[model samples]
Target: MSGPRKGKPVQPGQTVVVIGGGISGLATAALLAAEGHKVTIVEKQDVLGGRAYTFSEDGFRFDAGPSWYLMPEVIDHYFRLLGTSAEEQLDLVKLDPGYRLISEGASEPVDVPAGRQRVVQLFERLEPGAGARLEKYLDSAAETYTMAKRRFLYPTFQSFAPLLTADVLTRLPRLARLLLEPLHSYARRYVKNPSLQQVLEYPAVFLGASPFTAPSMYHLMSHLDLDVGVYYPMGGFARLVEALEKQARDAGGTIRTNVEVLEIETAPVTSRRRPAAVRGVRVRNGGGSVESLPADVVVSAADLHHSETALLPRNLQTYPERYWQRRTAGPSALLLYLGVRGVLPQLEHHTLLFTADWEENFKAIFGKDTFIPSPASMYVCRPSATDPDVAPEGHENVFVLVPIPPDPGLGGSGDERLERAADAVIGQLSEWAGIPDLAERIVVRRLYGPADFERDYHSWKGTSLGPAHTLKQSAFFRAGNVSRKVEGLYYAGASTIPGIGIPMCLISAELVVKRLRGDTSTGPLPVPLRAAGVAEGTVPKGTTA
Candidate 1:
């Protein structure tokens, strides 16, 4: 696909520095540069894609984070803004039997197919009258999903006016149904079977909260899976990173890797009425020397807590360390990336091995004492099952992820703990998936945990998916995208509004662009403006001067 056509340049647009080269940072940079701004992305890692980075060794390739691709429309919307489409740039293949679920002590694994009717049939097989109930449940879920996309996902929360829209008021009843109950309780009201209940409630776990604790609004995730469908790019998530990087570069956004942002430098406002504004970032260069890169505006798509506590001055931080200590974090993970020499015919492209004691498993993760439970629930992804390019001719690339608590103590001294957890995961997979001597077949193996998240991504409390989607930590209650204490400094990532996942990051980027442009409309760019192309002093309708 060709790059976006360059528009009439501004004589001197703002020099915007985006800290972090993750998806959100790249998307923000691309849009800003396309609008005639000078954009640069600074990433600490050797590679550009933060959590979505790909690594290859001995002909085996693996995506380090975010394996699932559930929301395609969000991604398509991003590409559309650049006058392109995801289909034109990436090879996307929708999974057939989307995933396989292995319940503890169950005789057979349940395969969840792509379409709604097929999934309903699977539900019926599990319980006598569940198919009809599932149909009802999904119909409600579809309505909830629609409300979310229209009323919640797209809009910026800078003011309360957006919440008073006619569309949102009309959907208040459905929104109440979603917000007033917990997901686990809501699902139980529809389905009586234990396994079917697990299937309906499982999506909440993806957001790093137990179904019992996560708000029922997240039932919308079921629609994303059963209705919208699950997909994987042919080359894994790494292809997405490559596409975003290309889009950013094509739009004249420069990315500098191995540059660690040590602090955000600021200048006092010249006027007493104005707040402090960003001057630049102080970065540690590859040679371990400090250098400053000046900017008119700064967008931090890095970890929210890291940005507030470590990067900004105490006086400029909006959220204090005590504020973070009181907040709830999403689950951290024990990740195992294994290069196996032989193929496992029994496993599907994606499989979830759930423990027998579901409540106990959650207790182990979110309870005060955080540790890996016996027979822990785990997710395994074999990308090579669908794409042969990720592994050698006779081999498979296996990714094992087990959710654990985000405990700071886990990071300070976690070697012995992680080793024990890895052994438990391997043994569980061996007995459950019929992969005997699983450890012996490993041609290569790398283990990552809370400490790795802290070291590599600077994740707060080593949480992988950002703050938990609890009642207090979601929507308007979540961290604001624009900083109130500092002028020309903004945030866009999992920690900000519209919350977690790849789709949310894309939306977050758009939100930041809207805030920067002073736009209030929660919709895609107008077709006429996109076609006519951007020009100086020609801010689109809904954007302020």
Candidate 2:
């Protein structure tokens, strides 16, 4: 046939099929549909949201994945892009004392306040003169955050020329410092206390990298968390998903659930350099028969490795199987969804139970061998503490997550090792919370491990998060959003640019759409009111970044 059109905006009524109905996929479909393109999403699951799916049993409801809601501004920005606001669609509450951190050997938990001043005070209490140091650290982090948003995160870099911009060149020294230093090393430069170090480095784990290995540039997460603030949707994350789904459907995008994409169909390109151009997708319908759907463009928001290796032809695959095997993956979580009959007075909405040997824990999870470490650090989310609708009266909805190495050996029918691991987690949690009969009070329990992620999401190595954000796998180093061999075939989600997390996935969708529409503008940078001289270095009262 003909060669795929290049450097052309997707015309109105042009067919676009998006594979995978996850947040990124849905967001991409919505944006394209809003531009008058005929967009359709094919999802394997019975519902939308993919990992962010919600499920209920009896009177309890649980957000299957991504419990923490950081970066409220990102969510708000996304909603605004779609001609609506998060406030108009979803009921959002700003959480004070964002989370509780209980370090090993500490008798009392440290409440991470939403207010920056209170956070400074918390640091001062932990270490003498730490308050001022924290201010300096946050100031540096804020600068990085500003530069990242303006020059990095939203941009679709076709080559190294984008990195040589005047604005970026002016900040070369600062950028170099951030890229060269490890997050742990940078944090240690500010605070001496171990607890404080953990507090600063904790956000790195969410990005699927240990602070020791992750670049200091990621410390911008501190600005996002401390200055920007944490938020919660009234119902849960699922509510946000529902809102996006509505946004997509309202924009004329079609969602087909219970349909699995078998392969991305491509035709030979006239250009000798380019092998093929996307035709559409071959999908196994709900009836169990495979059929092809025609589209001018195809976007696969599913697992990057799976899409390349399984769906695309072997010759067209960008990364080899060996490349994926050598690449470091983010941690796989041992998840426990528990419905407790009574209230947990000691627990906050979000709590981090840390181990005494933090170094060993990281080594065990990301080291050569894959297994659960002893005295593991765990994150617990109790949504019922804030939203009572998630559980029955006097009951609590809790999700306990323990990050472990993505051990391919784990999971399957009759896996006693998985059961033993669950037992260990429960016992540790009970002891840490000082709840004697915590296990007995559980009226409902569901265990999810690596196998579940592999089976359900087709995740490479069952990683809950995507690839680790190491220096070699970040920004331009990460998988590209556009395909090289196949024209009009694009990719999004955690596996591609801007990396992982909910907000990044949303941005990934926007970036892909920008590429498809040939929109070259990087968009406006989000400057806080204080930076604009509307306020003085503080988030306005009752407002989030």
Candidate 3:
């Protein structure tokens, strides 16, 4: 479906300073550079990819974040708009058992195979009529996913026009229920079996939400992993970040590392004007020199809480400290990076271990009186099962994540409590998942907790995935892409419009472009600019881009 255009089109050579070197920052730089913007990305860290940063220790290379490659179409489309393709950039591999699921004291683990029919058969075996239930559930999910992509996800909801679209108007009743009901309740309406039901529940955890609280609109999440298929970029997800970095540079954008943005500088548009216009960023370089990086536009791809509260003044802030008082932050994690001595046959490339009491575990993470869950459910990724480059020869690369309350009070990396939590997780996996020698086999280990996230990413409440995808924080309510209190200030990434995950970050970058281009099309713009007024300079004339 086509959308109407409004707002002013971008001029030829406006200067843009993109704050952060994360995926969204790199992507936005690449896009605006193609439009002839004098684009520069300033990263506080010495390396790029923000959370997706990679490190090599003891010959075991680790992708510090984003292990799953769930949405290939979003990735492919994003690269396509940049005049490249994911297939052209990265070597992708599809896994047969998309992921493995294990439960405490279960006789056998469940393998969610790649084929749809096979998954349905497994569902039926687990619960009578569940295969048909899964089909019905996914059918609804697929429709919702498609509608969201076409209408809700793509458009920069700077205006209310997107809300009145035919697709949305027709489904107002269905969407209202989705907004009101929680995911766990929605899933139970279809299947009663605990094992089969868990298939839906686990995604909510990774999404930084509790199944009992997160909106049912998120039920579409299962359709992505269970039905759409899971993939990996043969080396690691960091390789994808490297590809984006190269693409940004190739598009004539400059990336400056080891530079911290001290403030988002602003000035009044006129002496009488109410909202200030973004002038540039105040920065402190690695050499300890402070200077102003002047720009006509500034896009903060950093954490929204950090950008609004720390960078901008309180008067110019869109979301003040008082605002977040009512908002719910997503879960923070206790991250364990382990390099084991030998391969572990019990785990898959992607595996999920659920405690017998996952609901209680979620309460520990998201409830008002938050605490760490013991005998906790966790996610383990043994990428060495497929990607050999991540680990050393005769060794396995293990990454364990246990979701915890997003409280910075829990402390930083190497903190005693955090380490004890990691230790408990290791022991639980050894007993529950049948990896008896898990602890002793460890040759390398590192623990990262909430405080580490706060120190490195300036995350609000040290949350790893940004704000929770609750009803109050979804769609237009998530935080607008463009600022209302400041002119020429825009936001992208997991913090703003369209919400979380790698694919959403990609869309967020595109939404920033849409806002700038005044191209308010809800559907994704076609590549090569077939129309007279398409994206500038990214694609060449003719020859089927």
Candidate 4:
């Protein structure tokens, strides 16, 4: 599986040094390797899948980051590009009624069903004829998503040329309208129930914005939920990482774990054509080995600012420190992975416990910039319920997350504070799910907050998903896949163009490879040129004068 070659091969075996083992880096390596180039992914951690990585404790498995698997088609395409399908590599089952959302107590939980017809029916029951209105709303969402996927998503907007097409220019009005309405206002027009409205707005929170302020375009997520359908990989979300890791290796990409990148060396003068290219990377391992790996192309899937400031030399810095500091970032998550000993029948595959004071909770985090000691809203996922292999029989694997500001400034999430907050959340979960006395039912539990994300992943300011998708920090406004100042340098991750989420990160990888190769043909290229590519200085076999 390879992209069709357009011009002669631009550069051969251009040893691509990808710093980070997250899905972004792995996807980058896969695309580059498929193009007949030698690729190596260096990760600081002992495992692949950065924030999406998994950990096992005593027998219970947990995804350290991103538990939900949205947009199955995007993942399917990744596998297709790697010479297989998601079904062939892994087992995927669709979740019915995607999630359950409740307030303080759930005498009657708001069941958000899966698929368009079912969800519409559920809405109709909640509020008369609301389903038909939702269907109409979703039809519009589908159109927006189609436009977004084709016109905006797949293209590498490293420069404006890709986005300046006549087709896109004509679509500006729709795009502007989509961006104009607030998600809360937009949803309220269709659905009357406050609880259903909260359900529709959950994905915006994932973008690290409040529904009242988050763009109306976010309603596309609800459309994605009902249209695309919520799905679970057989062994849980971690299986995605494993599958991706295999693809990279299969494409002849090398992955080195426990190797932390310390510095990036780049050329000095920026040429208008090629600009400055990355020379190599210096790394340190736990065993105390410090060494530099040579490369012609370097793509960092790590935190954008960290790679620019800490890993690259001062003279090679692209953007100033003040730039990143001023940007709003997605909420840093407070995560809990719990292994329950007994049954909790009331809960579904996904659950959102809404806070009574939603606006106040948001203001506390985004506006006031403080951790909500008692966050009104939380997301809970029961992967084991859908995928039995994730845990032992009769036992359950649960992942709960609450969004908070990046700052833990004065005292951090102290022991007493985190415990108290977690307890309060569990209490809400219990009441919502109709599970009695959940506090005593836990056999195993693990808690992670801003401190853990910062320590484990080196996430900038302990942010969970990367920079917030604000107007100024989105699309062309965000970092380019190719370096603006440094040549042979690139970025592929949630922080870069196309924004956050697993699918976007995967595409970010593709964008980096596209920049290096400069073509978008489907399938593999000529064999001889593919076989003779060089790692650094030499021009690739297919290049022309």
Candidate 5:
């Protein structure tokens, strides 16, 4: 299953099986199929978009996962890779007041508006000298973002040689400090006010980490949020998933729903030195009978732990159980989906409610002695504040996410433990956000917890994303995208290289395509032969370190 010679225009049309129909899987299928491969995506659920799945009931449509759409250039680059553009597929709305911060003990909530200057001004108004410092911080972050997109993000880290290049060697001292220092400490270097510090540190949670543990290199995230701006694709994340599905189908990719992969069938090893080769995937069809789909190559976009530990034979499991045991998983969430009666004017399209005891709250989620916190920091998305089509005429679509310890035993929907956790958050939100009638106004309620994530996504430790981006688990230290133990077997999605989030997952798909092309360069893959414009800062091949 070795790829053709380098720089050769190889023949295509090899049958490729993509496990999991998530963003990475669908996007991988689109690229591969468009390249003349016969690509087929098999999804376990009745629909696609693994975590980005949507559901509707009683006139309310809800995006069950991934509400915030940050990193537009990544999406734009992906759209162009499909020979299309974001402007053509769906309407994207740039959020105003970027997001509302409801902080503990504060009389007024801080509304972070669109644009970098406004944020600087807002910080200036909050604390003297913080505005200028923040500007300096974002400037540094923007430079780091450029460096990462150019030399880090898209490449498959097959060796540490790429990290040893002269350019990287010259910046080793600075890069090491960024990678070793905690994000909280790094943010404090720029901002003095606690609230302003929180704004820069909060993105660690989305990376499945606490500011105390996450690498300061992730300050690059601030550029995406405060500089690139937060956006909401008008119809929700599922709509973006649908658009990717359309792209895959338009490129001749076959999509099959209600298909559970039973086993990743691999050819028996000819030598201990030569790993087992991919044969195909044995899957169970919707009617509960088994079927075999042969493939020259297989990409597992399912949870990496699930794919390696459960699907492959022990010999072929590159990341075994012991490997996962050493990893720190991102926090599992206690999610509340409520269709409340009437609108909540106080809530913005995106609301972040932080507990005053910020460090303690994170300790509750990620500490050695973990437990769900009463005054847990939480995020609320009231889609109705922006998109009217999500809910009935007057009702609001409210989704609450509370980061909790990733304990599968903490229980599931309708359980006492889960309900108690929800109660704690609801009570806190009512007081902190001044939404006095928050509880009683709920006309519809749905609860999801760590156990639900385990059951639905086979998430390791029920983590909402993948492993934490702690200093040890970032960059070259993070899990690789390809399987060294199995020829023609690859892993995608949040669990592998490049880490979590929708945009990263899309890039993970591209990385797999790059691997198949025998393109070992450590940089972003060249924009495919299409004339669609490239995203800002995307590095062309041969120009990277």
Candidate 6:
């Protein structure tokens, strides 16, 4: 029933049911509940965090998803909006030299520092006078990050109209120059050394695309990583999720874990403009009577395609299958979580192991849409190196991630393939970390792949970050925050605009909430998010916009 006309301020007591208790759902529930709306978060998993869940085994704690934590401001902003600080709530520590990267054959390692100047210095060491070039590259990337955040990331554009607006139209040429080029081209121009180029473009590998194909706009990630700094929450990443759950509860939002939403209820109305205005949700329990929860709004933070095609009443669907298929989705990642018996020597908080034949590796994964027998690059995170509490005094906790193609045809026998890949990476890491017989030292180990991601979080094509951040997938080109064909339904997380990583996902939630509530109390743009060309910028109430 279309109970009320559009644009009128309805009373805040209307029930809002958020399906999926991931970062996005919890965030939406928290913001809405804070605004006096009654909210319920229905999650399939037993825990609150979706892919970002945590597990404890054999005296070791592992952050199941999102091993690396970048962009502290996003987390801090969420707290500030709730009248608190991340430091006060979660003991966040700034990790120096954010991560380490090593070429499989090379004996030396490349360290990506936390600060811009330090990063530039490291670049110089890679190549003569590369530091100056790095500064210039970061400057440009920072500019792009600032412009996109203001003009694209925060705004809710149902279609291309907002992007083609008068303001954006006038700046088309400049914006294109900033975001349209390929990342590889941009990096090659600045850093001449192959090693330096590899380091600069490493972040794109996580998107499941090679730097040569990924849009240069993603280069903005470098600025986020270098300038803003990387941080780790004390205890573990699961603690961050726990803190968020607490905030949601404090704001009066109800979160139910181990509850799976089977279907969405909708009623046809002549006045309706979008596909469906949700009436409620039907959920299934372990073994009990089915529950039908009524709500005025149902936000599906679950799989975008799953919510539309499988969960929703098919007869009431708006968009066809072709539409979703055409939208460029990002790649899915295969991950390995292991607890070693002995502390890994010389291992930092974060490390990247790169293969010499990176192009070939990417071709095997992306071009062929299959798992490469030898992955081009892999990221290893040893949280124990930074947080002593993560592992036993003499032991270490390690999480390894290798970005691979999401196609099932390519990834044969997921778990078995992951073991083989993990073994390869462990072999290389053992050599790099100067450890003898690393596999034998393993005390605890677990393997996860695209299938697991698909099952656990309902990720489409088992993608970890939504879709690849290509030229066509950037900004307005990516999925919109609000569904075009569905009213009272919004999308958040990596697949949507401003794309991937924990920080951007968090920001996506904030952007969607701000758009829905029409709350505009944020402050002036923080230096980091301000456009380089803008003479003046205003920040929204909750955001250093």
Per-candidate count of clashing residue pairs (backbone under 3 Å): 0, 0, 0, 8, 0, 13
lDDT of 2 by residue, 135-157 (tens): 99999889888778776788766
lDDT of 4 by residue, 54-103 (tens): 88886788887787788887777766655567787778887887778777
What TM-score quantifies how close candidate 6 is to the native fold? Answer: 0.89
Candidate 2 is scored at a TM of 0.94
RMSD of each: 5.3, 5.9, 2.7, 5.3, 4.5, 5.4
Check candidate 2 and list the clashing pairs: none
Clashes of 1: 0
Off by over 4 Å in 1: 1-12, 270-274, 411-414, 527-545
Model 1 residue 466 lDDT score: 94
Looking at model 6, residue 543 earns an lDDT score of 31
For model 5, the stretches where C-alpha displacement exceeds 4 angstroms are 1-11, 159-166, 271-273, 529-545
Which 10 consecutive residues of model 6 have the lowest summed lDDT? Answer: 523-532
Of 2 and 3, which scores higher on lDDT?
Answer: 3
The predicted structure with the larger lDDT, 5 or 6, is 5
Q: Give a tens-digit lDDT track for model 6, residues 33-152.
A: 766678899999888788888888988989988876676766777766665567767877888878777776665877777787788778888788889988887887787776665566
Off by over 4 Å in 6: 1-11, 159-171, 206-208, 408-414, 518-545
| TM-scores, each model vs. reference | 0.94, 0.94, 0.96, 0.90, 0.94, 0.89
- Tens-place lDDT digits, model 3, residues 205-282: 656789998889888888888789999998898888998888788777899999999999999766523469888999
Which number leads on lDDT? 3
Residue-level lDDT of model 1, residues 429-458, one tens digit each, is 989998897888989888888988988889
The candidates, ranked best first by lDDT, are 3, 5, 2, 1, 4, 6
Predicted structure with the largest TM-score when compared to the true one:
3
State the C-alpha lDDT per candidate: 0.83, 0.84, 0.86, 0.75, 0.85, 0.71
Error of 1 at 398 (Å): 0.5
